[model samples]
Target: MEKLEQEMPLDPFEHIIFDYFPVYVEADVEAFLDLTSDQEKKKCTLEIVHAGMKRAAQAFNWDLQILEKVYHTIKQTGYKSIFALLKKSSPNKKYVCSIMCHHEVKRMDVYVEIKKRSGIVVKKEKLFSVKNTDEQDLLSEYGTLTWTLNHKVEFADKDYKKVYRLTFLEKDKPEDLVWKMERYEL
Candidate 1:
């Protein structure tokens, strides 16, 4: 392994690697697994979620305490299980964005407050609700909670291009909508 390493690139960051069990999987190799089938889809989704979480941790340089919790949560709950990333100082940070949860299909319709622009949400619609009070307080302080969901659908709706406009009856603007993540198949 050391001999091979001498020939390989030094910067591990330049090349994305997936640490699957004991082996290192290149990004392209993992991407090839078909997620369309019933069983394969579930497994693939889990892998993607795990990879995304790891990437986020590495990118953010999250605190050791938070990182330790994330590791335990992923291991215990499994990659497909839903998880929350709570914000500490920023109220806008709290909320569940994990697509792995079953209830998310219905719950994504809700919204919360953003306190003092304390964190990273650039657009208001992009933010969603979480179980944390600080996150809710932040959202409440920024603006009242709203759900424009016709709540997006997965699998079934992946084929459609048009975004379904959802809005709260009390408001004039369509705040949210149901749509699928775009993918191109050649």
Candidate 2:
């Protein structure tokens, strides 16, 4: 008789965040939530988020003091709003992408814009929005965007965890982009 092999279960922290990679971090967060026991979920979530934020600060060359300020703000105001900001640096031009989640209304918004060195927004576009449900709701549809090294953005949707490569066809037109969604198991 032939021997059979069995697959092992995956570890929750296998993909822990270590830098300013929000999409992967968020995915890790989701995986952690899914795999952890209810009794330990809250504590584990806070620790993972803190670790991820620390790594992100180091990777982005942000002041460590800012992290403290951020935590203080969260404690004082509650998590009514949460956001992640990413900067794409270029020699002569700079671009920024911001993902904001409003817990009060259970909505999330994505924005990508070009900014001047002085922090003035030159042009901006709203990439997408997820509305009408809390992020933690299993039925809620949400997604994340990742900036690739090749000057392209990729979007991953929560449902089925499908990934789509976003291609900007026109330099001057943000809306003139295409999404080529490829489905595969995570």
What is candidate 2's CA lDDT for residue 14? 65
Give a tens-digit lDDT track for model 2, residues 1-186: 011122333243566555324422332445554654543443344445665666657656789898978776765674445544444543333444333343333355555554445775545555556665354441234355566644355555565465544333334555554433333446
What C-alpha lDDT values do all the predictions have?
A: 0.34, 0.48
TM-score of each: 0.24, 0.31
In model 1, what lDDT does residue 137 have? 40
lDDT of 1: 0.34
Ten-residue stretch with the least lDDT total in model 1: 1-10
| Clash pairs (backbone) in predicted model 1 | 95-130, 112-139, 113-138, 113-139, 113-140, 114-138, 114-139
lDDT for predicted candidate 2 compared with the true structure: 0.48
Q: Over 4 Å off in model 1, which ranges?
A: 1-43, 78-186
Off by over 4 Å in 2: 1-82, 91-93, 99-104, 132-186
